[model samples]
Target: MAENTAERIDWRQLWASGDLARFCFICLGILLHATNETMVATVMPAMVGDLSGVELVGWSLAVYEIGAIVAGAAAGRMTSYVALRTNMMGAALVYSAGALLCATAPSMPAFLAGRLVEGFGGGALVSLAFVSVERLFPQRIWPQLFGVISAVWGVAAFSGPLIGALMSEFLSWRWAFGVFAAGGVAAALACLAVLRGPAATRQRNDGAPLPPFPFATLACLAVSVVLIASAGVDVTPLRSSLLLAAGLFGIALFFGLDRRLPAGRLFPAKPLSLATPLGNGMIMVAAFSVATVTFTVYGPLLLTSLHGTSVLTTGYIIAAESIAWSVLSILVANTPPERERGIVLAGALMIAGGVAGFAYAVPAGNIPLILGCAILQGGGFGIAWPFVTRIIVTAAPAAERTVASSAVPTMQRIGYAVGAASCGIVANASGFAGGLSSQTAAGVAAWLFLAFLPLGVLGCLAAWRLPANSASPAPA
Candidate 1:
């Protein structure tokens, strides 16, 4: 089937159709966005030194994430009302403004403010990129497109640190932020060129607007606060208790919203529907959950701690995963959708194995082992993400596609925050290699935390629920 499509649409035809160019532009934007994220982690300390807001470092990242989270649904709703090109341009403008703010920040408070604003734009842009694929491309090519997107991350991981380091060393840490701003400008220009004209500015009327503050704003607020409290800085009993209470309140509110809202208005269709593919959902959760911990925190820490690897090396290591993920993604994209479940299940197992290997190999202090584990994990990630995404896209109705797609990144961010917090708590308690007499304890804890990959076996079960008898896509 894939062979037929490949033969029919040659590269020239694909390019001529505009899908290829659109993907390229969006991918390039995402690639730069990704690079900024990884690069900044390496040069963050320098920023702190210059800015003297070491305590607010967590807030900088956290606030950005918070802004991004809030903007996800908003973007979806806007897409329904506005033209794709207009929506993208607006987001780019917001992002550019935020970047400029970051570049000029004179204090912790100011920098944090910049992150919050940037998050608003960044979140929308990222999710919209995926939504664009659904809106602009053929269903048959999603897996391949997703792989290509994943590869951008790999490329970013490989190159971001070097760019960040060079800018930081020769220029200043401020240059990191400046570089991101420049990238945003470049992407905005590309978008303007490729997606221009008055027709590009009109909003479609395919569906109703999403509910105001869908999924309960309180719930999202709580989760954000708890995540920040947990990962950001020192936790006192009072602060922890407050955060816990807020998080609980948020969770309760979300469930209430889920139950009370109508189908068209709800964030998740049915939170407690037993008939839903529980196994697949859990596996998906695990795959993303592991990603949150490993990539969000542990991977970066590994570079800064044991090997004293520079920002450049850290980027390269992360790039290794990106490369593996992209390669596997392209391979799986060509496979029949019927085989997607089995492929995903196999990928889950591989991811688990790789994580386990990393844990065992870490104690030996072999860099090769770590790199191998990253590659393995990347492959697993490559497989699971697109398959699960395909499931959601194929299952949901066209009108509800944006809402459903929003869940992917929402869950990913939630998983990442939870994973990073959990790992941070454990790693802090266990301490680093040289700091402790028995590095085994911390290493064991670290591996155990990352080994969350095996739990994705449940996703295999979810794949079983995909209707086997029907060739048509699932109802929205």
Candidate 2:
């Protein structure tokens, strides 16, 4: 199948004839997930103030991501066994319940529980959204459809924090949670209305029992994340180092156990090997994700402390990255086949330049330069992501297409989780653990971004290695 449809298909005609209602519902799943993430991020400070859980604040994000990672990994297989509509509706309901829990929680522990549940649902929503694209759309429209989804994320980037801030300031942070719950309920109903029948499932039953859940691997992965997250707290240096090491060991063990599993493996064959296109593309995704985590996780704090920027301005600056991504993705979604490899390589370079730009601009308190760098960084991902995703999905064996589709976002999330932890270690080592004074904040901002430079370089190398023709058949 030709991955590039620009030469043959009219995008306008495709949209005119396509099921817009179903597409909108599909996009809604991811929109809600993305919006809720930024909203929670915006409102967290207020939540902490009310709940009095300053010390346990980090765990809120940690637990949510841990749940997301696990649920995202499982979602592909789950869809194979259950109807897509059923899975999506159930996920939306779970999300709604979690939001209600958050709105009513009086203590930090209760709030953490809600976040975990919310993470699981949000993770499933995102992964399943990709799967829906595969199942619902013709191959020719895949890139354009992905472009639309990217645009939705761009919209969320602007609105999520605004809604969160508004709720936090006037209506109370709890109302923010209530609002998300309402969105989830609406999304659930949309899923019920739009998705129909067994055709939405990944595979038809052939009288074989459903495979056992990958419980052992999931447990290992979850524990690994928890350990790494714990290292970020005010622990002793020796203890933190030990925790990180242990966490890495657990991750290694997970790969080994997953490889041996007879069924329901988390990834495709030789998924970690760089020899295959799928593996290489995934590595590129993960490496770039790790490299960018410094900005998403710490940009607001560093910008506010060093540059004296308002919270809202810092957020929009950070959001410039997503805006750039959406714009660039829409521009190149239908690039001619011959131009893709060049675009991918160029995008990777742009990302690396953006990271380097941040290393200088952020610490120096140059807001215009910082914003410009953000656009470059986001634009880089925007340019390359659709192509990278299409390549990875097409290269997977037919039986594993669902897994491959989910794995892209799953890997990105895992990268974020791991990168956040690694940054925590670096921050502690560089005097950020003591709290951010102007001097300490400047030093931390520089080193934090500089630390990820090598990862970005690795991503560039991986992008270079991607096969020139992305539409080649999956390797046996």
Candidate 3:
């Protein structure tokens, strides 16, 4: 127990002794990762038009997601067997190389290869990043440090696209990739001095054998390919069905491997076991609720096709949701626990409302209404995330905390993948017409599909199962 305590040290001393400068740089790396993901979404349409690879547009994002999920899952295991410094540095190097490929790639295949590499690097960085809080801080201070980390995400959510837009408009979309590469290199070097200082690797005995890599990678790849392929309407139903079947089969096989891993490992022991029901339920709520943010795709398409708005205007409108989400997140960190639950539940309801508000958008023909609905939805996202995240990380037994922490991202990735695919199907079936559809039909679909979000209200009810006394004290 003493040794275990040493490994998962409490939060107070860790925070006090933590190198703040290191935190700043690490947050910057996180910001860059978020930026790359959002920016690519904004710029990819333009890039596809320019590169004439319209057919491959969906694959660009899908491939990156595939790489990231595999990397994140693998990183959890690697953390058990490797020095923290080695994992951090290795991921940085790999990510940087991937970014370089993206910047210089002359063909669609090459760019995809680059995205794949970057995904691995980005995945590893994110999966292990929160563990640093565990390593550096004691338990009492975990919530506070986690709040700081959450703030970084809020900032990245808003700024990434704006930055990407400027890069795409004034310079070239290629510059977006180039800038990330430079940032990745600088982050790697900074960590080398502060994090990877010598002596540890030379002493031997990192941890244990890494789980066999083959099945995990294959399963992830299959899932990503199927999801991406489904986005194209041209694929025959027969082919799509086959791909979907193969992907599901692969995922089933991966889980079989997951069961063979040790305790306090694989899929966050707490969530998997239903030990932290409130946290686990809320994370699942987040999965369904947050999907509404993707409605931004409708914003641009609406502006350009229906309202005759320019690209710049569309960009600002799309950015409003992110900005709203960012600002509300900070406010949430400071909220009291009783207030936090109410606020989070309210947020889920609001997300549902905002999604339903999509129906109002077309009838009113009011852009401001659309924006207002987005902000309301964004606020819900902002409030719910921090509280749920706090609960999940802190609620578990110390021995299982690492696995618990890991489940948050794992659930998020799987959720996002499923959400994107499912939403695409919903939008298509409802006659969304890409971005050019009449507001009336799009609004109805948005409302109907969003009905799934309020279903998350069920999570709030489940929170009751948590010990009545089990609540965090008011935020300082």
Q: Give lDDT per model, in order.
A: 0.62, 0.79, 0.61
Q: Please tell me which predicted candidate would have the highest lDDT against the true structure.
A: 2
Q: Write the per-residue lDDT of candidate 1 for residues 362-432, one digit (tens) a residue.
A: 55546788778878888887876777766665555666556565566666665554444444334443443
**Model 1, clash count?**
6
Model 2 spans > 4 angstroms off: 1-19, 44-61, 76-86, 103-110, 127-151, 165-173, 189-206, 393-402, 435-443, 468-475
Ranking 1 against 2 by TM-score, winner: 2
lDDT of 3 at 433: 26
TM-score of 3: 0.75
The residue-by-residue lDDT of candidate 3 on 1-476, one tens digit each, is 89767566444655567555556666666776776876675565456546644344445655676778778767756755677667777888888889899988888779989988998998888766765656644466566556667777767777776776777778887888898898888877866667743322322345664445545544754464555346443444675566556655665555555655554245543343444553555454544433553454334433444455454545565578788777787776777665755665676676766766765663355778877877877787777766666666667666656565566666666555544444444444344423323463345344434544554444445443433322743221
lDDT of model 1 at position 265: 48
Model 2, residue 15: distance off in Å is: 10
Q: Estimate each model's TM-score.
A: 0.75, 0.83, 0.75
- Report the lDDT of model 1 for residue 372: 86
**What is the Cα-based lDDT of residue 28 in candidate 2?**
86
